[model samples]
Target: MTAVTDQDHTDQAGDAGSENREGPVEEPVGGDADRGGKDGHTRVESAKGGPARAEAGPGRARAEAGPARGETVENAEGQADADSAGGWDDGLIARRVTAETEQAAAVEVRGPNAPPAAPLAYDAPLHSRLDALRELVGLSRARLDSRTLAEAGQVLDEAAARRRLSGQHTVVAIAGATGSGKSQLFNALAGVAISETGVRRPTTAAPIACSWSDGSASLIERLGIPPRLRRRPLQSAESEAQLRGLVLVDLPDHDSAAVQHREHVDRILALVDAVIWVVDPEKYADAMLHERYLRPMAGHAEVMFVVLNQIDRLPGEAAEQVLDDLRRLLDEDGIALGEYGESGATVLALSALTGDGIGELREALGQFVAERGAPARRIAADVDAAAWRLRPVYATGRRTGLSEEARDDFAARLADAVGATAAGEAAERAWLRNANRACGTPWLRLWRWYQDRREPPTGRLPLRAHPEEEATARQRVEQAVRTLADRASAGLPAPWAQAVREAAVRGSQGLPEALDELTARAGLPPGRPPRPGWWPAAVLAQASMTLLQIVGGLWLVGQIVGVMAPNLGVPVLLMVAGIIGGPLVEWSCRMAARGPARRYGVEAERRLREAASGCGRARVLDPVAAELLRYREVREQYSRVVGV
Candidate 1:
């Protein structure tokens, strides 16, 4: 039989040693149960009470006695040992168990430590962190919505990119009256023969842009220049370097007799960021330019250059004084200049032909471009000016909501003024009475029975009776609307007032036609039929009744004569009663006709009210509705800007 190593013995003890005794055992090192000897090896005894077996190497040997039941031993190499010594060696077994405990303690202290197990499940802490970040993002989005900051963000982004791309470009537009020499200054500044400088007033029809090679082509494109008028790139080195990124514009004359040229100047002035207002000695103080353009552009304080051109014509000292006067005028017009302790405008003197201050002007322009970076703020000012001009068009106040009680009161007052309720009830009653009259005797008798069954009138009816010829209620309503419109427009300027008046006139133009249509639709009596003289109808009816009464009276007298001795006084009394009663009955019928006539008057008043309400809705309320729509659009744009 092959000898079992100490490692084999420990392995056999762990796996029940019967197979180990039958064959050579291949036990794992440091896997021992009974290696309690000093060399860290253990010995095991055979089951037949043989000597304790000494295992080779540094491991315990397996015993043939199958680990001696409960006896346990250990090796010094920090492994569990299983072994047996017969004859009740309890103390020895206890010592062996203590040795195994010490070995395990040593192994725990010295062995390679296992890394912490990889997180087998999702990390709750990491998920919580992500949730916190998501909440922060949501809050930021909500803040943006509340303030309309998103639009500001977009504008800032566009402006920043534009600034990054725009270099030393200084865009200067020449704006002036018809004979202001704006084109001459533009050509002088450009140092080239680019624009059409002429002697005729309002020479420049369209805006012309001249730029040095170093200037921005994209900016010129953004100005919406057509190909033919676009100037060729300047190639002179000194001109190119000094005027690098300089965009000089010769704009159309603003005070031209031709409306198209004036409009062109106005449009380009509104779009360009910087304006060099070119004024000559003659028309420098023109009130038309001051009122039409300069006053309206009061908000465009930035990037404004007021140039007194054609100074060559004036005496040298007089030119300085003229510039000072012009600056004072600009101040009075509310254009604040930085040189005068304000933040924005500038005034300069220049002679385009003499080129007296051209170098200084160019140097100042370059400095402006360098210091200000770009004209973004000026462009924003232009936009604001345009928006300001449009504000009056949308300055309507909201319609106040009336209380329910007020509405009811207004309706009642209007109804009473136009007699609507009385008219409606009267129309129904009149139709009923007319039907009764048109019916023959049986229906008339029925109507009388119905009326007799009801209660009698306590006094006059609740509403006053309408007159035979009703008042002009439709005309009154139209006049009221007109008066209200006039009051609403009383404080407006002439142009605005005129616009309101035109709108009102247009709105009411169709009123007469509408009233005619309403009258036709209502089926009211178009006009009154001519009545015969009252005496004629009265005489006819009375004569017929009298004839009947006389015939009856004569018959009755004859009957009485046959029956008994007839008295002559009875015949006379019967004839007199017949004649008098006939006229009385005729008078009673005529009195009864008054009620039907009053009902017709009521219906005429109702027709008038209906026409008034229709006109009010179409002319007054409809125009107000359209104006409100325009106001809403302006409000939306304003809100977008102010972050409301």
Candidate 2:
């Protein structure tokens, strides 16, 4: 039933003197003064926490807009409100100076765009979830494309930041369509014309804010309000004494024809702690208001309020009917009431012009201010909204890494390209070739030695000797990696799928060279057949045969010349037996070499396959698999964020 405005200095000073004779009296609310308010309600006394004033004494305390260093505002009970706030004053923008008294603290005009003071209260689980999200962002930023849920991520970041700045300042944005008496309601609450009101269409082009305390400079600045829009030459008024810790903002009309005005409303809606939707009898259930703002915000019902302003125009019975109709529309729009949705919105009826029903509105605000739970509830709702946006990425069941069958197929493809099978064959051939020389007839061994000394080392075997073949092998390795990535990301959301693709080839930029190098180092083992433990015995037997041949040849020559006994039949017989024994010993050694050759070939194939698989794992599959794990981990964290 009152409005604070320009007051003469003489009257204000005289009133201040009279008020000092009678100090502030704390009345007993509950029957027992000791309990304060036992009915679950607290009568919040307006505590002093603004810029420092002279120590409370018998007369009015001297006023200052911004206190000097180390000045603290202590209440009559010696309880502290803001002790460590001198740092915020340095960042404060131009605020209008004001006067004050000992009973009522001087309320100064804060810089419209000043930063916030003091962070939100301690929340353990909240901090844990925050830490988990930071980890997800850091680990997956480079690995995944982070576009689809960008808004959600941004909301989380800003929310955490705002809470860090100041939890005590509850930013309640009053929003409504044109001709909704929105600005009038704001002025009525603030007890001053802080927001412009008139017959002009789409007035209040920008948001206007009026706070009850002085420590929320940073929060005001963060809302993007400019300094020019704030009220000037502020004063301490008695009408605003009941509501402290409240920062009321009059936002631009949501249904304005001006696009910038609508944009402003939309932007501020995302940052506020609570929302008050102002409507009048004329457009109480306007479809534009309900569809554009209310229905879309169904999940934020807990922090919402529907004010049916200009009710004085309706007759008592008509007002009831209109109020009922408005309730139906709110139900349709899903906007709830009460500080925490204790019941259906008690659709408040008021007349900003007539000043009727204003007391009830003030009481509702007083309770909201006293409870101090709206900020927390509003923040919680914001998280819920953000979580809803990310449901598509996390709602489905978790996806694991590349399956076993796929990995094996991929490895097999790379092994073929690396010429592991070719190396195995070369090993077999080389073992057999050496065995031929080791066990061949002693006389023919001389011809084999001549051939071995002439061939180049590479031409000696058919083991991946072409550059064209090596290039093809590299391509095959890269392709296998791509296939695995595509299969793993199938059916996932686009961002996650894109992330998988990026991760799949993350380390593959150097894959071609890497594969070529790996293949080059996987050379076949030595071509010589390993000399068996019994090689000496076999060689000795062959040498003995050779000696017999030599001796026989000499004897035969002597007999033919008739120089010695011509009937020496034993010499011819010894030469024929030695020739037959040499072939028999050579055949046995070649047979024994077959088993060793097969074993050596198998070993060569294994070594090449191992080397090729190592390259595939490093350049392709590992990054993709890491991205999949990150997805699963973030999905788990999203569930925790929603408190599901």
Candidate 3:
């Protein structure tokens, strides 16, 4: 066998440019050596000036070979051996190898200098993305409160089992007024003497839970009852099988002499998934139970059973009439039954002593459990209703939902009502006048020149209007605001409307006091004194003389001085007696007027803001609180259904 030599060659000179231009160079095959000259391969003679080195056959020596040529061949062979040992010397080879390995391995490259290949981009459907966002929002909402999340989880679990029938159960409660034989009825239902029946009006002071089988021990535990407090199961296979998941409760009389017994009855009724209202024929139409319990519980239409216990005492036709009247009363309370024949609310005639209709009642309860499959669906419906009720509470609308035109109109009307327009104009004129008075001679001259360039008022100036006159204007503005608020709250519910009204009253009552306080705090001057009626006659005489001065100068001036001197001198002397009178008067008036005006404006704005806030509280926050309560009730019902 022949051993094959693996030879590699690397050219150092001119290699950089060649590698840059042509990339990696391909090694020539063994058969192409003789045709290299024809294929443009270059050759050089040795320095000893002999013929170029020629290839010899294997194990053969070349004749007439110079020492330099021999040495050159040996040098070339040594270099070739060194190059073969090193493999490729180009940095590009390393980079290319790295790139190829990365590409083969399917790793992504992101840099601009990285290899040109399309990048991976994820594109999801709109609905799927929206669903993900909805799920995230739902999770965040669920985690807002630990109690709320726990309740919701319980409700969801119960809802998942809504359609199943095997694990279904009923919660028939023996409830009645005092001395109505509820305990005896409970004993009759259980087919055993579990409940203590006595001659007293309220024999059962506390509730007793009696199951047909011991399988309800866990359920009894969930009711927070100890083994000592619970009753033993009866020994009957048929009864046990029929009452597999049933939880028959014997409650204390609702109209007991002891208030605690009545409270216990009320509490247990709320917690139970279903109710068996055991009423005597005489007290079947009792107003206390009908109004307080039955009417309020109209929402629980699905899980209610009305039983006319002790039916043997009533006359044959009277019992039917009493049941009919009871049904009518329930219908008026918004408790809708499916029909007279097949209704959610079943009115049964039973005598605990005679055992009449006891088996039929048991069969009815069993059938109901088998068909309705437990209170899971009803509990889910309750939760769904609660969720729907809560939906409006957290509802938000776009701030710009109200039209721009409507908003602008409202703002304009509000400004007009609050005297904002008149106040702004008055402020501008007052500011200008005060500023002109405060300015030096140069600025005063410039102001006068500017004023002269503009047209003078053709009507009365606003400052000449009476102080009381502005109050009337302000009153008009306040009235408008009140009207607007009233109108805005018109469509709200009764409680919210009342809240808006209450808030408005509070705002109105507070506005004036706030304004007065602001006025008292301001450091401003007093207002002008009241003028006498004779001042008009005096002003007429002075004006007539002043006009004469312009017509007849010297003589008119002397006469005017003589008449005006005494009164004018007296006032001027009093004012100029080491008193800075002008500034004090101006300061007093500004202090009195500006403070109240600013406060009134601020208060009005505050009232409007408060009114808006109150509206939001009534229409949004309060509703949310109510909805949360409703949700809590639904959650409790769901927990009961799921046996949590």
What would the TM-scores of all predictions be? 0.39, 0.65, 0.44
Candidate 1 per-residue C-alpha lDDT over 103-142 given as tens digits, one digit per residue, 9 for 90 to 100 = 1100000011212211112134323322332332233342
Better of 1 and 2 by TM-score: 2
Per-residue lDDT of 412-478 in model 3, one digit per residue for the tens? 5534433344444544444434333332233344676677569553112232146585576457435
> What order do you get sorting by lDDT, best first?
2, 1, 3
Better of 2 and 3 by TM-score: 2
Best by TM-score: 2
Q: Taking the tens digit of each residue's C-alpha lDDT, what string does model 2 give over 274-381?
A: 788899899987888888888888777766777889888888689889988887788777766543557434468888877788778878776776677676666666
Clashes of each: 11, 9, 8
Candidate 1 accuracy as lDDT = 0.51
For candidate 1, what is the TM-score? 0.39
* Whole-model lDDT, model 2: 0.64
Worst 10 residues of 3 by lDDT: 100-109
**Candidates in descending TM-score order:** 2, 3, 1
